[model samples]
Target: MSRTPNPTRTLASQTLFRGLDVVDAVADGCQSVQEIADRTGVAFSTTHRLASALVQARYLQFEPRRGYRLGTRLLELGFAAYRDSDIARSARQNIEQLAGETRDTVHLAMLDGDEIIYLDKIDAQRPIGVNSRIGGRKPVCCTGVGKALILDEGEASWRTRYQYDAERGNIHLPLETWLAGMHAYAQGGYAFDLEENAPGIRCVAVPIRDASGKTVAAVSVTGTTDSTDEARLRSLIPTVRGAAQAISAKLGGTLG
Candidate 1:
């Protein structure tokens, strides 16, 4: 009987595997091309070519004396991966807990450029829930979690975003009024929707930070105006904030 070719090995790209080996060698402290070649068992010329390509693409950095080291591009990609993985892993329990406690919809989201992307969403047990999913995207100008994600930004940025949204008809609130609300939200360390994003939906949200004290994500409890009035939404601040802080703490962050 003939042996079936293993697809994993047969379909693998040798060059790609060699490049990864080069990266792994450098990660394991092999600085020189000769050292990397020895560590990866690849030919010296191939290793040198791979290293040069890596340096040009910023996967590795070269120094005259220090040799090669991991580059800023790797750091950026690593942090983004870490942020996403850590937030999802650390926020799952807290998100579930928040949903259970409030009996309302819960959302965990992160800012992506000028938009907010939902990383996770736990729908309420009730018949009506917030119209959001794990990967839904929303404008950063009009949602509670969106505002919470930008709590650290300056007034000028706030005005620019608000004006841009207003011009596009995504928002109708005057710039000054939105700015005033944002100021209060920043001071209080939380934000509210007040039906800004949708007709009757209200939400209370708080920022989740990382060890560097930067807001990497946000958490929110959402409900309809019938179930969550302004007073009730305000009341959920502490509950929502507690969940955000719990996730932040797991991420080595502090929240006040």
Candidate 2:
């Protein structure tokens, strides 16, 4: 299934590798052109030119003495791309529809590194509104939607990615708790937020499985404590699950 590397290919160009090293050096806090050159073993002139090009492209910012740092433009572009993503587009209508149906705030979230990133939300018609914003992050260990998404990933992944913070008081819990919750989720085909993320808010989430049957995203509904009664939320599960299924279908998810 594999071929050996060509010696010529491996040895041919030092410039490409040097350029990569310069970038790595810059990212690691070698702000000054000279510092970058020294750190990367590239020529000072080359480092200067590369740094200048990066600054021009707005990937880096230049300071007279401090040299350079990451630019705000990268963050702006990243958020723009994320907001306009296919996941966001596919989930938007369903999230809104669910919110309308349940008179609750609905959210769409995805995993980003070690945390859950909220990509979009729809607010209920009530006087008080949910405070979560687009692009907000919540810890995976405590949030319902986040834990559900990971649990849907199966046991091995869950064990690999999360740890029990005993100091935080059975943060991972005994195996029994994890197993019971997962069993409930699989049986119900949906997950609960359970006021773990916030004291007063409760949420229900369903997986947005893709064509390959992978949990690529999650859709959730949130509401005030008074309205998020257990029975009321149990009744809302079908609506939330239906909305998620619609979104998954729109995104070409291979549902059986």
lDDT of model number 2: 0.76
Clashes found in each candidate (C-alpha, N, C closer than 3 A): 0, 1
lDDT (Cα, tens digit) per residue for candidate 1, span 1-256:
9999787775467878898898878878999999999999999998999899999999999998999998888889865764667788899999999999999999999999888989888898776657787666888889999999998998988988887778778787888889999999999999999899999899999999999999999999999988999999888988998998999999999896
What TM-score would every model get versus the actual structure? 0.67, 0.67
Candidate with best lDDT: 1
Q: Give lDDT for model 1.
A: 0.89
Q: lDDT for each of the candidates?
A: 0.89, 0.76
Lowest-sum lDDT 10-residue window in model 1: 77-86
State the lDDT of candidate 2 residue by residue for 85-146, as single tens digits: 99998887778778888878888998887778888888787754566778777776566678
- Sliding window of 10 residues with minimal summed lDDT for model 2: 164-173
Q: Residue 152 in candidate 2 has what lDDT?
A: 63
Q: What pairs collide in candidate 1?
A: none
* Model 1, position 191: C-alpha lDDT score: 95
